[model samples]
Structure formats: C-alpha cells, structure tokens
Target: MTTASSVSRGRSGWGSTAVAVLLVAVMLFPVYWMLNVSLQPGGGGAVASPWLPLHPDVSGYAKALRDQGPHLLTSLVVSLGSVVVSLVLATPAAYALAQFRLRFTDAFLLGILVSQMVPGIVVANALYGVYSDLGLLNSLPGLVLADSSTGIPFAVLVLRAFMATVPGEVVEAARVDGAGELRTFWSVVVPMSRNALVTAGLFTFLFTWSDFLFALTLTTTDDVRPVTLGLYQYIGSYVQDWSAVMATAVLASLPAVVLLLVAQKYVAAGATAGALK
Candidate 1:
C-alpha cells in the first residue's frame, strides 16, 4: 500500500507540471508567432505564412531599428521621467493614507479608484486643450507629465496596500529615537518597504513605457513620437508592411519583457514579505 501511494503521488506531481508547461506555452504562443512573423521576408502582396522562419531575414529588424530608434529613445526618457515623478508623489501620499486616520482618506481613495474608470481619450482631450493653452502640446515634458497620470494613482494604490502591512511598532520606534515624520519615513519605512517600492516602481515604469493613448493624443508632431506611434506608420491606408510592423512590435515589447524579468524577484519578495511578518 505504501509503494502504491508513493507511485500515485509521483504521477500527480508529473501531471501538475505538464499542465503548467501547457499553460505557459499557450500564453507565450502569440509572442512566438510575432517573432516568427517579424523574421519573414518582406515582399508585395500576401506572403506565405509558416509556423517557423525556415529562412530567417534580418532586413525587417534593420528597417525597424533605423526608423524607430529615435522614437524608442523618446519612450525610454518619458517612461523614466514618469517613474521618478510617480514614486516621489505617490510614496508620501500612500504613507499618509495608510498610516493617518484622516476623515477624507476614504474619499481620496475612492477618487483614485474612480479615475481609472474615466476613458483615456477623455483625459487626453481635456489635456489637449490645456496643453495648447499652456504651449505644451508637442513637447517631451508634456508627454512625460501626461504619461505620469497613468502611473500615479495606480502607484498610490499599490504602495498604500503595502504600507498598510508595515508594523506600527517599527514606525513608533523610529519616532522614539527622535526622528521626525519625514526622517522616519525616509529612514525606516522606505527601507522596510524596499521590495514593495521596487515592485510599484517597476509597474510604473512599464505602465508609462507601454502607454499609447497619451503618446497618440498629446503630441501633435514628430518631435516627441514614441515607439508605439512609430509602429503605427507601418500600417498606412494603402500599404501594410507586416514584417516591419511585427519587427517594431517585437522591439517595443523588449522593455516590458526585460523589466518583468529583472523585477520579478522583488515582486515575489514583496508578496512573501507580508506572510513572513
């Protein structure tokens, strides 16, 4: 009976592992197909499609890099700027909301949640008029500020949730040692919540990186075009360059993929930090 039970448990573990692999493959198939399509030779009319690129071509990547490199740099700058602004603004707000029992705290949290429901186009349209009046419609600073709106509220919510889990005793001990609120926050809370901060900052980076709506709506000229807008040019009214489009998409997706791989450790640590405490 013992031998039979051991065999059954081993089979169950193998079955679970197989299902996990199948799920991962299903989720990754589109990425695989995009890469495959990007390597196909560019020609007129509908080119033949295949599961794999038997004869891979680099011309699409060459064209993509040549045309979209500036736009990709613009995206990187805007994304990094937005991360700085979001974390600086959201961290203090989150700490206050999580620690202080203010009367309007719930209302503020509600407003943040409701802001997510508002259409991006509506916000863009509103900002367009404001930006036009302020002479910021076709500028890098404008785009960074606009993209930051996407990260700020979400960062506030995420950081607030994590801050709520911090032990009050830890904060009080910092105060007892003669540290003021700001000092305590900077010295104590911030270090304790490093994993959570990293996780929030990682997501803020990605949110601003992948933003297309503000990039499309806020900027009227090519001076501040993001890679997403650059990708749109490959699909014109009459001609569609599928290989170049796929190539641009593959390049645009790299930051998100890289950020996820790098920051996933911090995210796991943050999630488990609460349980450990």
Candidate 2:
C-alpha cells in the first residue's frame, strides 16, 4: 500500500509540474517571439536566421527613446498623472465604503462596477463629442481624466477589500479619542492597508501606462500620445519596422515589469491578508 501511494503521489507531482510548464510556455511564447524579432537584423522583411539572433542591436531602443521623444514623455506623464489622481480620489472613497454602513452603499458599489463594464470605445466616443465641444480634444488632462475614471473603480474595490480586513475596534477607538474621519482614515486605515494601496497603485500605473485606444482617439498630436499609440505609428500602410516595434514593445513592457517587481511584496501581502480574513 505504501509503495502504491508513493507512485501515485509521484505521478500527481509530475502532472502538476507538466501543467505549470505548459502554462508558462503559453504565457512566455509571445514575449519570447517579441524579443526574438527585436534582435533580428532584417527588421521582419525576411528572417536571415530563423531560430536565433544573428546580430542584436540597441538601435531600436535608441530610436524608441530618442526619435520618439515626445510620445515616450507623454506616456510617462499621462500614466503617472492618472495613477496619482486615481489613488488620491479613490482612497478616501474606499475607506468610507469599507468602514461606514451608509444608505445606498450597495447601490453605489454596483454603479461603480457597472461603470467599468461599459465599453471603452463607447465612452471614448461620447467623451470625444463632449470634449470637442468643450475644447478638451488633444489634451493631456482629458486623457488623464478618461484613464482615471476606469482606474478609480478597481482602486476603490481593491482598497475597500483591504480596508475591510482592519478591525473595526481600532477605528472606533481612534474616533472615540476625538479623531475626525479624515484623521482616522489617514492615521488608522491608511497605515493598515499599505500593501493593498501599493497593489492598487501599481495596477493603476500599469493600466494607464498601456492604454492605447483612448489615448490615440483623444489626442491627435505627438505631445499627448502614449507609448502604445506611438507603437502604431511605427507600422506604415505598406510595411512595418518589426525590429523597432518589438524594441518599443519591450521597453513599454519594462515599466510594468519594474512595477510588479517593486510592488510584488505588497501584492503578496494584500492577497494573503484578504485570503486569511
């Protein structure tokens, strides 16, 4: 019986390992291909060497950073601005939702969630008409506002979940000592849900950073285009520069990678906190 159990356990372990390997391959294949193309010399005209990079160059990176200066800067500014604004606006709302049992709280939460379900293109079209009338077309603030609207819902949801884990007694104790709602949130709730805040902030940063359609449609000039839209410019009607496009993609991916690495601890902690509670 012991021998049979050991063999079955070994088979299960191997099956689990195989499943993990397959999942990893599925996720990494596109990234591997992008890197592969970025290193290819012929720029996707025809592969001189199919399997390996014959000659890798940093020229693509240089062009993406130097030649496309305004787009890169615009992406950075818009993404950062959106994330900052979303966090600032969402944090207090999330705390209130989590701590208070206000009338219509469920309805309000449902409304926020429903807003996220609305298609981006639909919102963009409506906003486009409004912005054009208001002279907000081709504006960075307009792009930031659009991104923030989507980001705030998720931020509030995640932060509220984290905030819910905080013991009510602590908040009550602070309030009993004469601390105001803002003070209690800042002093008690904010400090307790630091991990969730970081996780939500990182997510907001990633979403705004990678947004394309809204950025492209809302902004007409290089000064307000995000990196995602800039990538489309690399492709022409007749041909595309695969190497440069891939390099830009790789560079665009780096910020999200760095964000995940930096906030991985927070993500893990927040997830664990939610699970344990």
Candidate 3:
C-alpha cells in the first residue's frame, strides 16, 4: 500500500545510488588500471595494457619488493614514529583543551587553525635551514618531526572533539575515588576516547606513509628514504619500466588499504561518537 510519492522517492534513491557507484568507479579507474598493468607479463605495460590481465605475472611485484623493500620499511618506521609523537603531544593537549579552562585558549586554537591554512611547502622550506643547522636534514627523525607538524594539530582537534563529550560526573567520580589527574586521564578518559585515538593515529599513519613533499624536501639521501621517494626512483628522464612503477604504487597502497579496512569501524564511531549523545 505504497503511495505514488513513495514510489517516486524509491526511484530517486536508486538513481542517487547509481550515480554514486558511477562516481566511485570513475575515481577508482586509475587504481584499477595500475593493478591491471602490474599483472601484465614481461613488462609489456611500458607501452599499453589490456583492461584485464588475461596473462598475469608476478615479476613486477617481485621486482618492486626487491628494489623498494627497504623504502617500504622506512615508510613504516616514519609513519609509526609520527603517530607516536603526534599522539603523545596531542593527547594531553586535547585533554587540557577539552577539560580545563586556560587563558588565550580560543586564540591558541585560532593560531593552530591558521597554521593549518599555511602551505606545507612554506613550512618545509622554513624547516630546511633549521634542519641543516641541527643535522636533521636527511634523517628519519627529521621526517618524523616534520610529518608530526601536520598530525599534531589534526589529532588535537579530533581527540578534543570526542573528549569534550565525556561526562563531567564520570570524571568527577574517578577523581573522588582518589585518582589523580594523570591517573584519571590514563585510566578513565583515555579508555572512553579510544575510538578518537584510533581515528587520529590511523590518519597520522596514512599521512606520513604517503608523504612525498616532506620526503622530497627534508631528505636528500637514500639512507632514510620512504617508499614515496623510492617509488619516484623508478620514473626519471627516461621512462623505461612502467609495470614496476605501477607495481610499487600498488604495494605501497596495500598497508593503508588494510589499515583503513581494519579501523573502519573505529573511524566511523569516532566521527559520530558524541553526535547523538
């Protein structure tokens, strides 16, 4: 016993879903092409590739792993490092912002917002001189610090948003139970804000793992290059092997893809955690 308007709404909903699927396919075409090319035999992908890899090959992946393995490891280390540093700094800051009233708090937040508006390249160029003076230029630590500049502010906002909703009574109860600020933060607030922490950390990892500009600007040597830099190594003045290059991209994408899949629920919960509450 559906009305005409309800049937029209159902048709519109199907139309919207179809359009969304088309948009997703359009956006993911490049990724699909990359995988298709990577599976072609004998580096036949240098010129052109078929839509489907009727004849699959693992040589490109083998070559990519052989050549880019170290860089992949480097990216993993830098990404993990950035996450640790960002969360360490951001967690306390977010807690203070959400739980305490400090002077110039609004102004300080405005500053962070403004800093985000500033271009990354400008920040990179500025850090170059400081890094050179401190011997941080071309080092893993430097990359971690530079990448954390992006992560910290973002992590603070996300964590603060979620932490702001923690019931004051719950926090007070923890305090009345003889828990100190540090203990309460660690045992009570942190466990409550788990989803936001995961969300922030996942984004930080993704950012540092995929960072190219910072890798290109802060590092000049192969000693501590990330996979982003190593992937760029395949392309030069002469483009000889496209399959290996595409293969490296596919391999590099795997970690982030797997991480997103694993953390998808936490990310969703974090985003909508306090909305209804």
Best-to-worst order by TM-score is 3, 2, 1
Give TM per candidate: 0.89, 0.92, 0.94
Predicted candidate 3 versus true structure: per-residue lDDT over 1-277, tens digit per residue? 4798899999999999999999999999998998988888744645577789898888888988998999999999999999999999999999999899889789978888998999989999999989999999989899999999999999998998899899999999999999999999999999999999999999999989989999999999889999998888766611566778888889999999999999999999998875745
Q: What is candidate 3's CA lDDT for residue 172? A: 97
Model 3 spans with C-alpha error above 4 angstroms: 1-10, 274-277
Rank order (by lDDT, best first): 3, 1, 2
lDDT of 2 at 46: 27
Q: RMSDs, each prediction?
A: 2.4, 2.0, 1.8
Model 2 RMSD to the real structure? Answer: 2.0
Point out the higher-scoring one by TM-score: 1 or 3.
3
Please give, for residues 40-102, the per-residue lDDT of candidate 2 as tens digits.
Answer: 763464244266676787676676676556777888888888889999999999888888899
After superposition, candidate 1 runs with Cα above 4 Å error: 1-19, 44-47, 237-240, 271-277
Looking at model 3, which ten-residue stretch has the lowest summed lDDT?
233-242
lDDT for residue 70 in candidate 3, whole number 0-100? 93
Tell me how many residue pairs clash in candidate 2: 0
User: Who wins the TM-score comparison?
Assistant: 3
Evaluate residue 190 in candidate 1 and report its C-alpha lDDT on the 0 to 100 scale.
87
